[model samples]
Target: MIGGGAAAGTIVASADPSLPDRSAAELLVDLQNAKVDGLSGTIVQSADLGLPKIAGLTADSGGADLVNLVAGSNTARVWYAGEDKARLALMGTLGETDVIRNGDDVWFWQSKAKTATHLTLPADAEGKKPAALPTGVPSTPQDAAEQALDAIDPTTEVSTTGAAKVAGRDAYELVLSPRASESLIGQVRLAIDAEKKIPLRVDVYGKNAVNPAIRVAFQQISFDTPDAQQFTFNPPPGTKVNESTAGKLEAELDKEHKAAESSKPAPAGAEQPTVIGEGWASVVTAKLPKASGDEAKQLDGVIDMLPKVSGSWGSGHLFSGSLFSVLVTDDGRVFAGAVAPETLYKAAAK
Candidate 1:
């Protein structure tokens, strides 16, 4: 079951809570088998990826903005009764955005815009689920933990740090680290509730960094079933409403897939992406999308802001952060990964 391995680091206790000791394998089993019938809680997500500061890119900038997601703190309220019944409300200074899923009906509401989108799932799509929040932000620790766990393999070293306390409940700390030297990531920690066996917190640290670059945890939580009204949505007067169906979405996706398959293939290394390396050191290389007019000018302006570099790999701009590196080549190609800049440079050479 070990898919990845990494060297272990010193573990420090967060709290002196008494709890039974568990092995890393046992904890993984518990997390995989964990189940909760219903719950409601406040979730806090924060990130400090050491990105360059840009104007209007702070947390105050709309909650759904990509810059806000990676650089500042955001809070969201969540309610879950089961796989099909759930609600998430993201709070911001101006207003709140909510996503509610009750059975086959899903609603997305943005109070500031006074707009709502509704979609009905196909009857035969049994286990299909909707996103709790926007694309970048993870709505809960469980959501973040699942992503981290998926990276576990023989190349990862998994172990329990110690007992800890979170959200006023006892928890066990599990750590995963990458063995690949090229990986920019140092380690990932998950705090699993001792009693519930569900993850309550997740922390991701950059290589040799003291503080976490990304953290998603619960500030407050309740295991009791939430009120049914929490999942109900009634649009305000004059709110713009848009409706869609799963069948239509599936048809559109299928049409696009068929079109792509039938289209003439581009010359080698033209537009398609290539994967270099594997696991944590993997880098993806692809051609930048063609732009023109105003979009082209905007893209050039942004590229100019990044630091320029040159070598056998050619000349382009480089964007390096605590946990990732991105290289844009003058030849219209881009390389990015959760790896050191040297790794990206090697990929660019190929």
Candidate 2:
């Protein structure tokens, strides 16, 4: 996983050649040869984005595709054809473009906000493909599927549960567990189309407050061919685009982050709290809970300043610092968990 959204899910590679009625290599050629009039799929996702980047710690809901790849759409396009740009999430909420490039550079460009930040891409960037593009298009099902699939370790365990229908399509039920990483999904049961050879639904599990409490399920799919026009966008005039390289903005954000952290009071009887004049995102992660005595007390008070949260069910707890999350139960008990605690703090703090 990359960003804070990174996690390990059990990866299951089908040994059965998904050929309609040909050799496996021919199947690859046929699958590649087949043309999708339009590709549309519904997405219900629960992510643990981690914070100080703050917004990363909240649960998010939305759907998009090539049809609405610009302006009002929560869509992004990357050159998955190769490593060009690994993935792009172009929601303008933060007034910036979130670009994950080649799994090594993460740059954010916000015009009106005049803020640009960069992060090092995850180690997995090397073998990855882009997640989206200017127009809604598929580099290949193999590429797209692998992008999601590679996130899971193939060596993890798997089991078949039963059968079900997804988006009105018949599907096989199965559960998967990551043998090593329990980050993204604790366990997942997928609804797959044994015929079309595509996933009908993806259920992700986690316990972090910002992530889904039990699991997130996506239904309502329309792989109906999408119009070709959905893949690109026209940038409006007068929109200034600010961008940061892999590490440019961190220095500035870190400065402010450190300053606010220093202003906090220290533990009782201790010298004043350590004052970091100019702080960055790292400072928020450092000053969070786990402080002793006065430090912890001050941190708790600071946490109380956050907006109170709850689900339709009564459950939520914003941990000290910028940990975004809510309770998971209809009765409200389980915490959704942190999406991106340190990232969230810095974002909310701003």
Candidate 3:
């Protein structure tokens, strides 16, 4: 069961008893055609990824981004002005971190570190362009909804579940659930703004949990266009400024991905994952760095700090949250997914 504290963050949904009913087909059409000229909002992100408490192991560690999804709540002020301009100011106890994009330029400013990273997007060739612009931060729900809508297939079942209110806006509930029994995901629910036709909130549930494991929603939103000045930034006088181009970054990532896929030992980077099943309960396995005696001991020390679990598949550490679970085996391998731990064991045994 989810704790009361975390449950409080969920949208307190209530049925619109007096509102007229809308068909699922009509709602889907609105979602596909949804567009907003400009908007700003306060987004609340909360997660309960079933992780154990380890001292010094925080949401901002090596897996900070993923950790934050299940262990803590973060608030950010987001502004969007079309596809080419946007800003996100992440509010935190330390200070604010801001990401801003205007046309081909992007700036990431860390207030506590007093640093600014500037990046420029590569220009398209005469006949070619990148599939999408490098926004450099998570996209708005409306943007993400487009991709999620496109992913509908035989593996998923889509339907509507009445109406809800999110951030004070009336919304229709759209639910997508996997058809396969092996999937860990119970359902993905999206609250679509009835008038705006954009997602106002998203909730993800696991098979074993009644509450959403992950929730991202607007606490407050405005439809009026934000001032153009919001998209511009300048580093303070003594702040450290670094510069790079998007093309170079993309090339480096591609190189790293290929290295991860190779069976040979890889340097420190994200390991490429291989799928072991289909649908929701699929296990994703990734190659781990090969370690010697001393290196293995050092790695174990780090792993020991995380929650420990052992079973027929062998001993290793488990890092889990509500929507996802990761198992790092002793023999240099890692398996993970949004499913239960037993599912991972099956992959490890194989």
For each candidate in turn, give its C-alpha RMSD to the true structure in angstroms.
Answer: 3.5, 13.3, 7.2
CA error at residue 264 for candidate 2, angstroms = 12
Q: State the lDDT of candidate 1 residue by residue for 1-350, as single tens digits.
A: 33445433344434344666677777888898999999999998889998876444333455444555688778889998998888888886567888888889889898999999888987875556674566655558987888998888666877778777789988989999888899999999999998899999999999999999999999899999998888889999989998988677668779999997666455444667888887788899889876677978988877878889998989999888899999999988999999988888888887
- Compose the digit string of candidate 2's lDDT tens values, residues 123-149: 655644432333332232234333434
Rank by lDDT (best first): 1, 3, 2
lDDT of 2 at 305: 48
In candidate 2, position 296 carries an lDDT of 61
Count steric clashes of candidate 1: 13
Name the regions of candidate 1 deviating beyond 4 angstroms.
Answer: 1-17, 55-65, 125-127, 249-269
Top lDDT prediction, candidate number: 1
TM-scores for every candidate against the unseen true structure: 0.88, 0.37, 0.77
> What is candidate 3's TM-score against the reference?
0.77
lDDT of candidate model 3 versus the reference = 0.72
Give the alpha carbon lDDT tens digit for every residue of 1-350 in model 3: 11121111122223487665665556666776788998999988787766777644643555454456457676778888876778888776667778788878888788888998787876652222223322222345655566556545557767778788899998988776777676667877889997888899888788756988777788999999999999888888899998877777668789998986774565567477789876566788987766667877777777877667888889888887666788998777899886777888888988
Q: How good is model 2 by TM-score?
A: 0.37
For residue 264, model 3's alpha carbon misses the true position, in angstroms, by 9.6
